[model samples]
Target: MYKKILVAFDGSPYSQKALTAGIELARCCGSELHVLTVVSLPEYAGTVGEVEEMVGKAQDFYRKKLEKASQQAKTRGVELKIHLLFGHIGETIIRFAQEQECDLIIAGTRGWSPLQRLLMGSVSTYIVRHAPCAVLIEKGKEEDGNG
Candidate 1:
């Protein structure tokens, strides 16, 4: 029933799985696929020039990520749209999905332990809690390539 679907992806292998799954879903539902990547401000020393350099690299990274995902979706015969945003990862995802009127959001989970999750705050968890639409979290494949 989905008509527009948004997927949150980073360059991680886990996020790659989410892109794949989102593509399949979009194909099945004849939905428009929107792939979102957040170019976060790196947490470190930030001189003006250094900040500019980091932002440039982040832009390039997201550019490659969106291109890769778009190519994959093209091979599957689904129309794909790319979105890039800058801010806290979770907030950016939530805002974009709302603005685009996505029917569902598909995101990848990195499988952090309870203590670690508590320390680092999970993006998937945050999106699921805050998104106005339904959300699906996909865990990346195992070493054997099984689900």
Candidate 2:
């Protein structure tokens, strides 16, 4: 059974799936649930003020999403702890999982093609390869409600 479960969420449909799965798993195992959303700053911001502005904007945007997710978990009788950090997606997720001592990491995938992943570098893939704990990846179901 998992003691702590971390869901890497970004408010996308794919991440929504991950959140749902994480909630279910936490409920089943009586685990602590955490949702982490990371904001990756632009490589070269013109000024430090710009970087702070970007983080502020991202916080404003993700706060609502995380709140909604918290409500969702509440309906399932699970308490959700949320974290927002600034860093590369995969690296940040891994580091947070380690720091939080998560027993499981759940993430959703966009189902990128091999070629697309090669070029774009999939975050879920990177996490799967490098995460400190066990990882679960959720993929979207087909239109027929099958996966």
Best by lDDT: 2
lDDT of 2 by residue, 1-147 (tens): 999999999988888889999999999999999999998998878899989999999999999999999999999999999999998999999999999899899988888788998999988999999999999999763331121
Model 2 TM-score is 0.93
Task: Give candidate 2 misplaced runs (Cα > 4 Å).
Answer: 141-147
In the range 1-147, model 1's lDDT, one tens digit per residue, is: 999999898868888888889999999999989999987776675587877887788888778878978999999999899887777899999999888899899998887788988999999999989998999999644441122
Question: Model 1 TM-score?
Answer: 0.90
**TM-scores, all models, native as reference:** 0.90, 0.93
Best by TM-score: 2
| lDDT of candidate 2 at residue 140, scale 0 to 100 | 61
